[model samples]
Target: MTCTIFYTTAMPNDRAQVSGTAPRKPMRWAVEYLIKTPDGRTLVESTKTIQRATFEELRAIMDHIIGAIGDEAGNIASFVSWRATARGGRSKRRARR
Candidate 1:
């Protein structure tokens, strides 16, 4: 199994900016992870928007996710989408077992 992670910054629209306030950092950051089989079929996709934060912190989180996927590559099909977990989908123990 192979996994790819994609992420980008989301800028706020003019309406979100205050006339007098300093420009806000990006409205949020969008992150996505795509889990695929060796042949290139997408098995699962997860996306999330996180509030602005320090680069180190964000990088740490991204590293953690990538590490996790690598650790679980052998059983990738049993992995659940991160988005689904946020929405109260199957728990990790149940998903794997």
Candidate 2:
């Protein structure tokens, strides 16, 4: 199975993917998500979340958000992603008995 991320600038009344579909929300909250690839590029899987949204009213709204998050990282804040590849790959090793 596969899943996708939805980005919203407006405070999410809730995380419900679509109002009529998916489980409803208990309380509305301001929430947004930004997904970047290990290469520091925005992933292309984002196009899949536009199923029921209106073209004009709904905007991706993440280009600016990405820059903001990067800036926040420079400021050194928690949950702030400075770079996707901050933790590089580890050296391969064999298990020992």
Candidate 3:
């Protein structure tokens, strides 16, 4: 089996607003990962958000996750399905509110 892993970082916009009167918190960044099969099918895709101060920590975490997934091909589908179920649950809860 062949696969490719892609990573990207997203920076927060300058005009973001917070809900309270307190000063806005430091910028938080998002690290996104995309795992794709040889035929261009996406196996797993997810993003992890972290404060700027923890950028290096987030990078390390991303590297670990990528390494583990690369070492275990069989777990890709399971990860994707689990994410789907979790996402569905969140959406259902939002819809009920």
Candidate 4:
């Protein structure tokens, strides 16, 4: 299986401005996920937007992606991510295992 991820920053109050006593919050992150089989068969392709994604929410998404891929040869089970710098460039140092 092959997986690709892309993330972007969300606009402030892009959806709406509601009148309420509670604080107003807008989604801050949007992530796009694509999963495909080795044979080029698409499994899952979706985008998730959240105001603040909790650990459990992220974990569940990972579990779902993994379950869809299944455990098979030539599948990627581990992933690493690098934080971009303020200039929109990758970190100076690479991620270490």
Candidate 5:
């Protein structure tokens, strides 16, 4: 199996800022975890949406995924949506595995 990590910075609500109230800080981050088979079919996904996550919380999520999926979790295929960035090293890691 392969693990894919999708994460982005949380955005503050606009309404709070427009209402002249202090905008509540959103969780520092948001993330989705997915596991896929070698043939490109999704196996399982996180049921709970992580819209607000601290760095520690994200790490905990990663740990859980790793425990569930084994060492394959260490070879993550990460994509950063905000920056339109994708890691090029995923193929190398997959090859190693």
Candidate 6:
């Protein structure tokens, strides 16, 4: 399954939750990606939403938008999003599993 992530306008309720996570530092997120929980319903970090999505659909969005979006970032860290390593992340588990 693939996941697609996109930026959305920060909602009123979103502000409080986001702030709580990375307190004492300025926070900025361009988008939000929603994923379903194991129970088969939609969840937004713990907040449930009626919107539902399939993995393939989200994957397409990531490829088209996110995969090519950032590199020389003007806003955040290298790890905030997934990145394809030039030579792989030098993994031990990757060799085993």
Measured against the true structure, the TM-scores of the candidates, in listed sequence, are 0.36, 0.22, 0.36, 0.29, 0.29, 0.22
lDDT tens digits, residue span 22-75, model 6:
212221222344433234444233222212323223334444543333332332
Clashing pairs in 6: 4-58, 7-31
Off by over 4 Å in 1: 1-28, 39-41, 75-97
lDDT, candidate 2, 1-97, per-residue tens: 1122243433356232333222122211223344454455552222222233222223333345555665755523222221110112234588999
For lDDT, candidate 1 versus 5, the one ahead is 1
In candidate 1, what are the lDDT values of residues 1-97, reduced to their tens digit?
Answer: 1112223222233111112222223223346565554545564544566665333355566557656775777644322233111111222355554
Determine the C-alpha RMSD for candidate 6 after optimal superposition of all C-alphas: 16.9
Of candidates 6 and 4, the better by lDDT: 4
Please report how far candidate 3 places residue 65 from its true position, in Å.
0.4
Clashes (backbone N, CA, C under 3 Å), per candidate, total: 0, 1, 0, 0, 0, 2
Give lDDT tens digits, candidate 5, residues 1-32. 12234333233431111112221332433234
**Candidate with more favorable, higher TM-score: 3 or 5:** 3
- Cα displacement (angstroms), candidate 5, residue 59, comes to 2.0
| Cα error of candidate 2 at position 33, Å | 1.3
Structure candidate 5, residue pairs in collision: none
Task: Show the lowest summed lDDT stretch of 10 residues, model 1.
Answer: 14-23
Alpha carbon lDDT of each predicted model: 0.41, 0.32, 0.38, 0.36, 0.36, 0.29
Residue 47 lDDT (model 4): 48
Name the runs in model 5 displaced over 4 angstroms: 1-31, 44-47, 50-53, 70-97
- lDDT of prediction 3: 0.38
Q: Which candidate is the best by lDDT?
A: 1
* Candidate 4 TM-score versus the reference: 0.29
Which tens-of-lDDT digit does each residue in 10-91 have in candidate 3? Answer: 2244222222122123234444555655455675454554444232343465556666876776444322211100011111
Residue-level lDDT for 3 in candidate 2: 20
